[model samples]
Target: MPVITSRDHPLVKQLIKLEGSAQYRKKTGLTLLDGINLIQIYCSILGKPENLIVSESYYEDADNKHFIDIIFGHKPPKITIISNSLFRAISPVKTPIGILALISIPALKEQAYSRKVVFSVLLEAIQDPGNLGSILRSAAAAGVNNIYLSKHCTDAWSPKTLRAGMGAHFFLHIHENSDLKHIAQQFKGTVIATSIQASKNLFEISLVGPTAFIFGNEGAGLSKEMIQAADENIVIPMPGKTESLNAAAAAAICFFEKVRQERDSILSSNIGTK
Candidate 1:
């Protein structure tokens, strides 16, 4: 394994830039997976990476040696070794993971406008990376196959967002820079948005068919245009006197309510057949 001791090494400089700049990442079509779990997910899903980077401070390095020697050494792969200090500089987190992988970002196909029974979520101007990530994870778990992020939302592919998503990004068809109203206009099924002024309750609506849930910014909630775009304006019933829910939490509740409704519908249909 070749060791990179100098800060001037081309790979080090490139990685430092990648960690710091989203524009650079987009330009290069590259992103770094910071920890072992993420690296493992990428490898398991997409086969071997082009390169692996390890820190000198990594304890029990023989495991990596095994991986490199067997799985990664097909073509004299560059599993570059570097000092701990250098790794810390390139890492985004406060505590650096011992190893990382340099790989091309996975390019998933965009979800086309279709009349099919698809479950979707449209996010507008969600600024928090952690919140965005949590929403992605919940969306995947709740069977929302399509996600549309407006142009004003934070970068979905950033390392922080990626970490927050865990491996959920692989499962979702994420569409960015979307037009929410246009999507609502073209949608075949119900378009639902939450509001404080809504007369209807969220639980009363049937999400059995194709449904699109639109959630807005944390502080601003839904804009007037987005609210007008929704086919139904409903409120999540809160008896506890809370003003509102966190965007991510509200999204999860909305998703799982759909899930619960669908499950009950399935049971009802089964029973009716009997």
Candidate 2:
């Protein structure tokens, strides 16, 4: 592994730009994946990273040597060992993980919708990176087929969002910079919009078939255009005095309900066949 002690190294300068500026990330089509788990997941799903960076201390440690060897068991890519200070400078978190990878952003096709996408979540104007990541995680866990983010939503590849996603990015099909109104119009199945004032309860609706769930900003909720474009407007029944749920929490509830309903349907079909 090559050693990099200077913060002014060309690679270090490039990483700093990618970490600090979303525009730079888009321009270069690259992003950073910090932490060992995230890197491992990326390698497993997408293949080798363009560059693997490790702090000097981490590289020298005998305890971590075996783990590193296992990570590179297949064809390894370029590896660099940098000084701790330089690693900290490039790290986004307060406490550096001592390892990270510079990787190309996965390119997704610009299709209206795929036939395999029976269930999806559309986010509109969700400004919080953490919330967006959590929503993505929930969507992936609930077996969602696709995720659509409005142009105003937070960047999906941002470091904070990637950290919060906990590797869900590798498992799901995500489309960012999308126009929710146009997608809603083009959708062939039910488009369900969540609202605080909607009369119908979420459980009362059928989520067993093709459906898209639209969630909006934390404070403002779904926009008028989004709500108006939906085939059905429903609200999660909250008996508690609390007025609402956070966007992520509400999305989790809606997604899992769909999962539960689908699972029950499958079981009922098997029983009928028997």
Candidate 3:
């Protein structure tokens, strides 16, 4: 393994550019994965990364010996050990994890869109990366088959969003910069939108069938075009004086409700069969 000590190293410069600019990542078709957990998930799901960069201190630590051994076990990706200072410069987290991987962005396939999706999420102009990531995490947990983001939404692969998503990205078929209106128009199942003013409560709706839940910006809620495009509009039925739920929180509620409905429906069917 080669050691890098200078901030001006070609790889270091590339990492800096990737970390700061989504455009650079888009141009190069590469993204950065920080921390052991993310790198492990990426390797498990996608295969070997293009490069694995570890800090000299972490590489030398006895506690990390097992992880180092695992990295060496997959010999294709060249590993580079960098000075602690250089590693910190490249890292986006407040507390540096000392390890990062440069990997190609997973390509979205046409087959992904062709599948009969049971549950899906559509986000429009969600500006906060943390909110988007949290929604994705919840979506994955609730067994959402696909996620579509409008063109105005934040970059899903940004470092902040990636950190927020944890390992959920690997489990999802994420389509970013999508046309939400077109998707809504063409969807085979119920297209639901969340609003505070809607007459029907979220729990009152039947989500056992194929469903697509549309969530929008933090302040404005869903666009008029999206609301008009939806098959039905439902509210979360907040009895309290709170004006609104955060986009992420709202999404989680909707997704898990769909999960609960589907699980109960399956149980009912099993009982009838028995």
Off by over 4 Å in 1: 63-77, 110-117
Please state the error at residue 152 of candidate 3 in Å. 1.2
For lDDT, candidate 1 versus 2, the one ahead is: 2
RMSD for each of the candidates: 2.7, 2.1, 2.0
lDDT, ranked from best to worst: 2, 3, 1
List, residue by residue over 15-110, the lDDT tens digit for candidate 1: 888777878988998887777777767676777667778898673477766755654455634568898888888888778877877888888776
Q: What total of clashing residue pairs does each candidate reach? A: 0, 0, 0
RMSD of 3: 2.0
Residue 252 Cα positional deviation in candidate 1, in Å, after optimal superposition: 1.1
**Tens digit of lDDT per residue, candidate 3, span 1-274?**
5679988889999999988888898899888888888888778888888888889998888777577567557364777899988888888776698888888888975554543447889999999989999999999988888899999898888877887898788888899889999999988899999976688989898998889999989998988889999999999988898867889999999998988898799899999999
After superposition, candidate 3 runs with Cα above 4 Å error: 71-76, 112-117
Error of 3 at 169 (Å): 1.6
Please, what is the TM-score per model? 0.89, 0.93, 0.93
